[model samples]
Target chain A: AQTVTQSQPEMSVQEAETVTLSCTYDTSESDYYLFWYKQPPSRQMILVIRQEAYKQQNATENRFSVNFQKAAKSFSLKISDSQLGDAAMYFCALVVGGSRLTFGEGTQLTVNP
Target chain B: SAVISQKPSRDICQRGTSLTIQCQVDSQVTMMFWYRQQPGQSLTLIATANQGSEATYESGFVIDKFPISRPNLTFSTLTVSNMSPEDSSIYLCSVEAGGGETQYFGPGTRLLVL
Candidate 1:
């Protein structure tokens, strides 16, 4: 069994600033994938970024990035130059091979202008 | 990213009734899945919609409760039968593109069983 944990239930960041959402998981599989998904007020889940466990380098997608520490079982998402659109519920997920995904509780991000 | 859409964006149904949510993708996909997201909770996979075969349900979920239909590669549906207040949640469908590990999701159907 796999479990994902998001310690922070809510997070706030000033406009144009940065915010980091913490996530940790427990999995015995050595090869797996980590993902960050965003669900806005529209209730549509969107993929923010993804990181492969085998790769040591972090995954960066424009304003979003991930710090994947395999040894610590930590995968945190960092949003840089945050805007109002970045305000949403972010989820951290883990998937091994072609299996189903296990998701975290989610962190609700609020960007203040 | 694949574009996905779900019908009946939100519905309020009476207890003991049923609701069917439709999921459609823009292109042909290899794998389709249904998930449930309760209020203030994370997403839990309900079943894997396999084309030309019965859906593979997850533990604690049965086909009798969540009857799934996958007639093709780009479309699927999930019906919630004998609904109750406990079944009030958002139902989302996702698809994996061409055997890819990543999955894209639909907008989700919000069901309020009253």
Candidate 2:
């Protein structure tokens, strides 16, 4: 079974600063997908960004980017120019093909203004 | 992106009772999944609801306890039978987007057993 791990239970970053949330996974499959999801107080889970295992280039979406090390099985999310709205519970998820996703325990991110 | 909605956003029920949560997707999808998130915990897969067929439940979940129905591609229902305090959690429904590995989740139905 594939498993995702987010070592940081909680993280804090000052507004306009940068913060990185670490994530690691264990998978035997060579082809898979990794994603970072944010759940705010509204309870709506939104996709932040995604990376395909076969792709060597990291995925970047505006202020969000991932440092995906395929060999290390590490996928970290970096949030730059953070804003107050960036505060939320961030989760790292993994899925091989169209199968079900395995999620990490999640890291509570707090943007200090 | 797909818009997913879950009916009865929240409900408080007595123990031993049952509650059925409905999930509706704006667009038709091939697969629908049910997940449970306990208080301050991560999401756990309950089952995969396939259209016109029975749902495939994961380990620790059974059809008798968490019965699911996927009458069509865009609609599904999950019934928590013989509910107990342990069943008090947020129930969510998700679907794969554009045949991709990424999934979109509903707002979730918060169930409270009293």
Candidate 3:
């Protein structure tokens, strides 16, 4: 069984600043995928970014990037130039091949204006 | 990326009642999944709604309690039967697009069992 863990229960960042949310996973499979999802007050789940385990280069999407360390099984999300809209509950998820995803407890991000 | 929509954005039902939530995807997809998110909890996979086949449920979920139907490639429904206050939660439908690993999610249906 694969498990995702998000250590930070809550995080706060000022507008235009940067913040990083830590996530770790335990899996025996060598090929898998990691994802970061954001759920706002609207209750809409949005994909922030994703990283493939086989890829050495980390994935970056605009202001969001991930530090994926496969050996340590660590995948952290970094939000730069944070905006108020970024405030939400962020979740880290892991999935292998076409299987279902395993999600972490989540980190509540608060963007202070 | 695919656009997904769910019916009855929200509903309030009495205990022991059943509610059916619909999910529609704009594009054809091969994989569709249902997830449950309890208040302040992480999302948990309830089942995988496979077209033309029975849904595969995860551990802790049963077909009698959470029935799912996938009539076609882009449509699916989940019925929560004999609802109780503990059943109150947000249900979301997701689809795996052409990409094998990435999943697109619906807005989610909020159910409150009184």
Candidate 4:
């Protein structure tokens, strides 16, 4: 069974500081996709970033980027220059071409001013 | 990215009743999915609504419990039947866009079964 694990249940950072959220997954399939989704208090989930396992280069979107280490089965998300709006529940997800998203227990992020 | 909208942003329903949530996408899409999110929890894929055929349900979710309908590419509905307190959760619909690897989600329908 493929499983996504987010070790940090809660994370806090200053408004302009950097925060890294760790994520690891167990999957037998070599070709897969990893994602980071942000669910704010509004409960609407937004796509933060995506990583393709075949691509060695990590995925970056604005201040959000992923450190995808396929060999280590690790895909961690780094938020740089974090803003107050970044405070939300961050969920790491995995998909193996079937389109079904397997999500991990989210890490609640708190941005302190 | 697709602009998706769901009807009845939030609702309070009585137990034993059923509520059908509608999801409409701005553009045509081949793949649409239904998911359930418990309070303060992660999303769980309930089923994949296939066009013109029966929906493919995930393990632990049944067709009878979560009957889905995808009549066309831009529209789908998910019905929660015989609702109980345990069924109180946020139901979300998402569509695969771009390369089919990325999915854009709807705002979700919040349901409270009492």
In model 3, where do residues sit more than 4 Å from their true spots? none
Which residue pairs collide, candidate 2? none
Candidate 1 deviant stretches above 4 angstroms: B98-100
Model 1: per-residue Cα lDDT over A1-113, one tens digit each: 88999999999999999999999999999999899999998889999998889999999999999989999999999999999999999999999987899999999999999
Q: Tens digit of lDDT per residue, candidate 3, span B33-55?
A: 99999999999999998898999
Q: Each prediction's interface RMSD?
A: 1.0, 1.1, 0.9, 1.1
Question: Candidate 4 residues B1-96, lDDT tens each?
Answer: 899999989999999999999999999998899999998788999999878888999999998999999999999999999999999999999999
Docking class of 1: high
Output the lDDT of residue B66, model 3.
Answer: 94
- Number of the top candidate by lDDT? 3
Can you write out model 2's per-residue Cα lDDT over B36-97, one digit (the tens) per residue?
99989989999999898889999999999999999999999999999999999999999988
User: Interface RMSD value for candidate 3, one decimal?
Assistant: 0.9
Q: TM-score for all predictions?
A: 0.97, 0.98, 0.98, 0.98
Provide the lowest-lDDT 10-residue window in model 3 chain B. B95-104
Could you tell me the lDDT of residue B22 within candidate 4?
98
In model 3, the Cα lDDT at residue A15 comes to 100
Q: For model 2, what is the error of residue A103's alpha carbon versus the real structure, in angstroms, after optimal superposition?
A: 0.5
TM-score of 2: 0.98
DockQ of each: 0.82, 0.77, 0.85, 0.79
Residue pairs that clash (backbone atoms under 3 angstroms), model 4: none
In model 3, the number of clashes is 0
